[model samples]
Target chain A: MLEKAIKGSKLYWGWIGLLLLGVATGFFAYTFQMKEGLSITGMSRDVSWGFYIAQFTFLVGVAASAVMMVIPKYLHHYQTFGRVLILGEFLAVAAVSMCLLFIVVDLGQPQRMLNVLLHPTPRSILFWDMIVLNGYLFLNILIGWVTLQAERKGVEPPKWIKPFIYLSIPWAVSIHTVTAFLYCGLPGRGFWLTAILAPRFLASAFASGPAFLILLCYIVKIFAKWDPGKEAIQSLAKIVTYAIITNLFFLSLEIFTVGYSQIPSHLLHFKYLFFGLEGHATYAPWMWVSVVAGLLAVLILLFPQNRKSDNVLAMACVLVFLSTWIDKGMGMISGGFVPNPLEEVVEYIPTKLELLITLGVYAAGFLILTILYKVAVGVKKEVDA
Target chain B: MRANRRKFLKIAGLATLGWSVFPNLLRASEGGEGAGHVRWGLAIDTKKLNDEVMEKAIVACHKNHNVPHIPDKREIKWLWKTTFHKAFPGQMLDNMHISEYAEKETLVLCNHCDNPPCVRVCPTKATFKRADGITMMDFHRCIGCRYCMAACPFGARSFNFYDPKKFLKSEEITTQFPTRTKGVVEKCLLCYERLDEGKKPYCVEAAEGVIYFGNLNDPESEIRKVLAERYAIKRKPELGTFPSVYYLI
Candidate 1:
């Protein structure tokens, strides 16, 4: 099965070459950053974290999206997701790998990551996040490998695999929830110290992850000639519709609390994100784009006729992915840092080096995603024939 | 009081663990809370902090610690000057023209909060509260995540973004205190080495009556006496971080 990837068309090799180029560029930039230290990046003391951490936050949600398919198939007994389930699980594995890489690139001391394990401070949310993220990755791989082997052999998956599959449902939610706790519990960061952040993270992850999966399935249908099924794509679109609505609702709840209370510390970050703080409105355009894309996705996804059409469905999913990508990748993490601890607004803009490293991580994820999808599609194509 | 017992147990636990497992590890991790028997604190009289004394005190403190003089983009400061309004934005008075302390330049450093959010958020135990309540940073252990910097409410913590050694004039760099590396969070450690040697803090010695230093847990100490006599105020008192620094306004 692994050898199947070696035999590919010119287009496949070209895609791999493009991703390889991104990885090499990122690696070159990272070596310089390692020697010169984090100063090479645009992050300052005031806005401490930059592109790496923001992308990490967004990818964690994408990793958690695997449970969207898991819940529908195992819990709800939805047959439509049976063929699509492996794709979501593989995405989780690749997404989690990217999340881990982003963290490494973000570190001022990446070499000292083992300190979390050695020291093992349970009180710290970062310590717990490490545990859950790795645990989620482990569970997904075990479930995916064993189940795929059983499918190939035309036999039932072992009884032992069932319990792990069940356990993964909650484990998926925990990864993103724990990640949110990393931001939420800090006392001074008023933008992040909200109760709704974890719920909001889960809602957005469910929408965006499956929305991307919808597009991926279409790509597979066109390129690999693997039509997962029309019903499968439609069912996932419905999930995206409800998930985005809930994500929007959780965001409004946050807005209401911040707006009604009118506390300067609490409301200042929202002002910075949406309207720009102290005339640094660089993030405002991106945030407003998210708002419009999100609203448009919801409208398109809601109507029965629009959602059923392949063209509208494709457009809706792209908008949904972009909407959440900006919300989580651009706004969620940095928004917390806008007004630094002293209530001074210090906006962060990513340097070219930072963007290069980020792109490198995304390319690595795509590489993992490409290989895994190729294997899954090959296995499915053989079984069907 | 509860935190005292908790920190003591943690130290004891870590001490025993270090003895059994990581004796070499403890040697590198020496910047623990200073003079651990009592809660160390300060009470500063703003009226006494004249321009000459403040400048002398700041210089002494920075010189003793090898605190680098870097550019604005990559600044690394332990003690510095800020305006009264900037230091205490929440406590600003409407009629600044009438208030004596309104326009005064405030001496600022790490608040060394009783409930340090930095210690709580650090992935590694690189930064932790010692039993005496002085928040300590083991630069050896700091992964430079800057989570501690973000968690600090007073904007006290600074990261060594660039190589500080690059900017320091060789003659000016002190040999006594080790300069921090390029990628680690550092802050006012309340002069951990000086406190260990039974010497008064450099700033406290230079300022004379302006800066008062003593054990807060000891009721008979001068800082406690100042707090009892003067209406001293800590920055952002309502936040419940229980900052050890107090100002005799």
Candidate 2:
């Protein structure tokens, strides 16, 4: 099946070439970072985690959103999703791989990463995150491959595959939940201390993941000349609509609590992200863009006529993706660290090397997604013919 | 022959279980010695801390530990000075008659919490709580995730963003304690090395009478005596970290 990836059009090869270039550039930057240590990045003691961690947090939600397709197709026997379910699982595979890569690159001591496994402490949320994330990656790979293989053979998938498929539903939820716990369980980080963080993570993940998938479906329509089915795409748009609304609602709840209570520790983080803390307002513009785009996306998605038009729907999906990307990828991490525990405002800005490394990680994820999607689409075209 | 083999297997299984449990039992006994017997603590009298005394204490600890002077906000610090309002945010009221105390410089260091959030969050157990109530770091085992830095409420922990050895002159580097490498989290260990050798922490000795270090568990200890006589407060006590460091206002 990987042979399909190798035999793509000139355009496909060019895209692959660009991605490989990104990977090379990132690798070059990473070597420099390794030699110079994390000082090459913009992180200070006050804001210890920067861009790498934020991307990791955002992509975990994307990885876990594969469950949205799994639940309706396997559990409820939804036939519209049958053709697109493989795409979702493959996306999970790519996203989880990126999540893992981001973590490795972010490490101050990447060589000593095995210490997490060599000396596992059950008390640590990171330990559980490692287990569940790896487990999820394997589960998706096995389930996606076996099922796609059965489809190619025109035979039923093996009975043994069912339990693993069922397990993946909850396993998908666990990946994002544990990632949320990594922040929420921390004692001093008031921004992440809310119990609603896990639920909010799921809501945003369901929105952004499906929104990205909707965009991918259109790309497949143009490039592969394959429609993933209008019904399937519409269903995903509905999921995105509801999930983004829920995500916004969760944000409001956090705001209300912080504003009403008037607690400086919790309120200051919000002030830093939305307005400005002390004199620094680096993230305020990005945060407002997320908010306005999210609201506009909801309005577009809520109307049936607008959603019925493929062009408008695609526009809305892009907005949804951009909105959640900034919310989680830009705001989530630095918001927690800005007003350092001692009430000092220390801001973080990513260096060029850091941004290059980040782009490299995203390129690596897309490379995987491209290959997997090519294989799946090739098989689907063959069966349809 | 069957009966003898079964009996031997039983004994072997019991021995294997005992070997596994034995280390935990030994650890429990070792911890028990200091559990209720010797909880190391410090009490700082802010009134007694002048600029000269605080500077001397900071210099002494840094000299003893081989901590680097990086000349940036990223500099590694075992002990440092900050204003009273900065050290204890939200504790000072705007209309208070003692508003001048808000600007007063006070010395701060690792609190060595009784229940350390850093120990709980560390994936490799690199940062751990000692039986004697000092939070300790195993630098070799650290993977440099900085979760400990995130978990610490007092901003006490610092990550080695750059190799610390570069900032220290060879002659000035102390042989008394090991200097840290790049990509690890470190903080004051409450001078456990000196305490082991029947000596006080460098800051305690340097501060003259401003800083007090002794066993909080011992009723007759000097720290307890100071706490009894002075109105002292711990930083972020509401967080339930139960910090061993007390501040005398």
- Quick one: best lDDT, which candidate? 2
TM-score of chain B of each: 0.84, 0.87
In the order shown, the candidates' Cα RMSDs to the true structure are: 6.6, 4.0
TM-score per model over all chains: 0.93, 0.95
- Against the unseen true structure, what C-alpha lDDT does each candidate score? 0.87, 0.92
The per-residue C-alpha lDDT of model 1 at residue B212 equals 95
**In candidate 2, which residue pairs clash?**
none
Highest DockQ, which number?
2
DockQ of each: 0.53, 0.72
lDDT of 1 at A324: 99
Could you tell me which 10 consecutive residues in candidate 1 chain A have the lowest summed lDDT?
A: A338-347
Model 2 alpha-carbon miss at residue B17, Å: 16
Error of 1 at B114 (Å): 1.5
